[model samples]
Target chain A: MCSTCGCGGEDASTRVTLVDGPQPHEHPHPHDHTHDHATRTVLLEQDILAKNDLLAAANRHRLAERGITAINLMSSPGSGKTTLLERTVTDLGDRRETLVIEGDQETWLDAERIRSTGRKVVQINTGAGCHLDAEMFGRGLTELAPPDGSLVFVENVGNLVCPALFDLGESARVVIISVTEGADKPAKYPYMFRTADLVLLNKVDLLPYVDFDVDLCLDLIRRLRPDVEMLAVSATRGDGLDAWQSWLADH
Target chain B: MHELAITESIVDAIVEKVGDGPVAAVRLEIGRLSGVVTDSIRFCFGLVAAGTGLDGARLDIDEPSGRAYCRDCRREFALDDPIMLCDCGSADLDILAGQELRIVSVEVR
Candidate 1:
């Protein structure tokens, strides 16, 4: 049994109403004996993410049919994800009706940052989970209610591990890595890189000051995800912002 | 740490799948590259399954090695590490498998 939060043999799981659906409920069934007490294995091949995946599929179809392009942004803590969004919002500035869904373990700080740009945004506090699931995205989509042809950016939790397992029904997944951090991040967190449609190598201005090797980083990222597109840019200096912006525009 | 949520998902799926019946055991297929901690999920499962029909149900985890296809060497191999280069020392590769996370069966008496 876990001593912390009593999560081992108790109801320590997080209770969240992030989606509009029937909540898991319990009903007493005395007919549990209908099996004649005979042991039988039920052939049920289902993904553990099946419930979440179904919601994600629905979200994907909904977004596509609505002509809304949603992007899932993932990275480790302090990867400058929010900073890039700030620039994107300010630069795009009326070009696209953008909405943001910020996921965090706790706090409304990221949402506040995006809010500073005067754009529509919502915050999701996982409280216990490490990543935001598709159900949460569905709820966010409903709450945001973005207009047709609008763009949405789902800023996932800071951690890279668990978020990769979840598909939030976004049009594309973008993983951001800063040169200030290890270049081998793609190697260490392969799932994140593998699932990403594009990788934004942020903070390129620090490349010279830092000892990060761009070639090595690209090679490592390719190993985990062949044919993954990458763009080197400094969110602070606005260097290479055109490519990043165009990437969004094209997508 | 997110294993708690993962376990909750497992409990929710099992409950919805088996209905209001006493589940005796559950068989799972966890790919080595699924990035899930089996032990943590096990611990969380015990906690989350207490009130459901899956209470006291034994969990059986089957591991599947991660599979990959190396384009440089034009060879396929099982990936134990994502950064692992091909036999030709090339990082050009495409992952083929080892990302599955699913339940294969559920036993009830």
Candidate 2:
């Protein structure tokens, strides 16, 4: 009999052990064990975007508490967002304190342009990053010195795809599609158009020269986002800017 | 793409949880409105998991349906319809679900 346990009946060669030690416990057997086929459903139940959304919500509350109205401006490169901001700042500088948060992959050129307007401006060079997230916005807000009853504009990196997914705690999201670009922009990038609160058809001065259809573009935008407000303006020539300024005044 | 960044985060999370174990499979719940392109995520998964602890692990995605509630009609309906209309033909509605994005669970040996 074995000396380890009283239940031992035979010698080491004759005795059969049902359970083995922890030596190979890590590697389970490959046999057709009944428990192996048992379906164990686990309710992990967690949101991957929950963390980002929580941060965005907190940022929104902070903006509200500080009496700041935030706007996220999205568009393709060379959509004249900088020019529009320059005109807006020049027009509304005396009425309300305005700040611009410029996001670019590299260079502080846009921020320099806005600074000439004599408004509070902060530039975020994403450094090979495509989009701006809530964390970056939160950090930029501190440096931008967001004042109460002020309007804050976040000019997202010049892309329509990734920025649309990120919520930068902006009260409004405006998508700018210039008339120089194709009129099918609203149709091609439906997700961005659908998510935007407003769409600005910039560079309307080129309407007569370029093969652009304003009505067709408006129709496509309406089909995608029925409630989205739209404005047509030419920042370079200062056409239809009074209406834009009035809209800003009301906001 | 942003999916590359997201996949990096997932890989970091997995390495933290399971050091070097043989991960059998991973199940992810991707919501319809999560704005994550499923194909891009899958492509990113393959690229990010290469030569890592999660090599050869299968990715299973569960795409759940979305729902929206109509404030005018006081009812809930599917979000896939052409129009955001309620039973009473009202157009104003608020999205209620299908905005999820999560790594639900994993099977390891």
Candidate 3:
């Protein structure tokens, strides 16, 4: 089990320790100082997510130094992300090294599914948090210890709204939306679509049975991100899997 | 929720800067287009700050309205939604403001 995040099984490949302890603050002066009685205003002028961003940059540098490619895969609940990952890993068997860092509010299921494919996988349970921050991703990277030139997919928690706000220092961000969901998802969740490097319209096999308008969904996503690359994929039915794999290789 | 994490981040930042000193108040500037709900943060602040130096600190927030520039109209206007569009019926908008999630100042005792 992961001793740090407390989310894993006994046979887990990696144990990721998340950031939950007190920060290491360096003090220039060790001497005792007198307390002031008057109230003082400290002008910070700092961005709220600056710390996260800095940590993400560090993570990016570390990954780059090791020649590792990290992909941040995100989507809402039941977007077939895990299934897609399983298929991707299975199809790329022995051809390339793939590792997964699975994030969920409360679950070992996704990680287990990925691990069953004989690939190294780690799970992160955020408890109540909606998104995986940079520090958490860093911890995951440390535990995974991915080999050089390996592909590490960080599967984010199932939430389109919050996950888009946090940068996990990945080489690319892939947002997946299934045909079972609304066609206006891009319009409703503009932030997710706006920040995506690639959009995967999954469950194309079920398109004929569903009411989802593929063209409309693509149009809405294009409206938000004019030149974002997109693909129609059926992770369950093996449709457009080659294109997805090629895209990954190209990236 | 993400707000809980954001609140924890705020407390962590404050403690890092002030070394657990008594914080009287914290001033923040949240933008309308930042995708964060101010009420959610306010609700999570007290809980996340309970054992920290900012336990009793007043959480003061300034919400900045979103502003964007329209390329077609060659004018700036307010934007309240993430689906940005200009008054001239153009989607080519350059956001000028409203994504600010900043910690402006902190009153320490």
Candidate 4:
């Protein structure tokens, strides 16, 4: 049995794979090399996410050099992330070149939705992965390759927890929550709210029909992130979309 | 869930440095506020480390408690999770520690 977590047992094997399926990131080579006979401790004092962070930094540099603006959109499963992207991409139109990178566990549905809006889109299926990390984002960036001074929207997988942990080197992060997701979400998922540069309270048109307290939700989000800018919008009805567009313009 | 991906990174990093040989052990420092579960990583290590130098290697983990400093009250306190609030009833706080996810060392044999 493992001492720390007691996870070791007969059923201990677990598979790790990339978006391409069973291919691991690195394969163990059969190269002959000398092994040290004596045991020696090598001090590495390196952050566990160092590789991801480095790739994210490189991605940031690449985007900056091309004068591109990237926004990472995160939310739960039914937060209207794809609907919002479709509207935003179509509305922006000729004003600014907009592209999208769609991430999901399985399916190109979101990518097809964006493509239908006449925007260049890249679909990344993470298979069993819950979030899109920097490595995957880097691959998407390479495929999309938005033009200079364009806006790139990365629609993250619909999960509030793990998406917040991985930085995709976006210019800003926007967390979208609809009226149906409850007001206490900011408190329940503080990390997601805390890391957001902006929060969008989507589906405002349904607020009158639902029991979502807008003021209380804003208050809770403010408690977690005092400096983050918050907005309300209904992607379907075009309500409060002018402000959302203006915010996008400013960025 | 994400621990499998994390464990893969850990194993790949150590193997890159030490080569595909019999490693003795690896040490990691995991903090409570890092959002990475130690138990999940432990469950994933052996499986992720299987065809590499880290196969059958002992895993040593050091857990650090969450610590935060309240900007409003100028006082330090312990935090159990990511809900950042000071004892002075202030939400404005700076986290000092407990977000670490670091590889401390590796013992090669």
Residue pairs in clash, model 3: none
Q: Candidate 4, after superposition: displacement of residue A211 in Å? A: 2.5
Q: Grade the docking of candidate 3.
A: medium
Q: What is the TM-score of candidate 4?
A: 0.87
Query: C-alpha displacement of A182 in model 4, angstroms?
Result: 2.4
Docking class for candidate 2 = acceptable
Q: List, residue by residue over B1-89, the lDDT tens digit for candidate 1.
A: 77787788888877776687888888888888788878988888889999889998889999888887877779999887656567787
Summing lDDT over every window of 10 consecutive residues in candidate 2 chain A, give the lowest-scoring window: A9-18
After superposition, candidate 1 runs with Cα above 4 Å error: A1-37, B71-74, B89-96
Give every collision pair in model 4. Answer: none
Interface RMSD, all models, one decimal each? 2.0, 4.3, 1.7, 1.7
Tens digits of per-residue lDDT, candidate 1, A1-251, equal: 12223242222222212123222223346774443444566756666776776788889999999999999999999999999999998999888899999999899999999998999999999997789999999999999999999999999999989899888899999999999999888888887898889999999999879999899999888877777899999999998899989999999
The clash number for model 3 is 0
Candidate numbers sorted by DockQ from highest down: 1, 4, 3, 2
- Distance from true location, Cα of A84 in model 1, Å: 1.0
lDDT of each: 0.84, 0.76, 0.85, 0.85
Poorly placed runs, candidate 3 (over 4 Å): A1-38, B71-74, B87-92
Instruction: Please give the TM-score of chain B in predicted model 4.
Output: 0.95
Ten contiguous residues minimizing lDDT sum, candidate 3 chain A: A10-19
Instruction: In model 4, state the lDDT of residue A77.
Output: 98
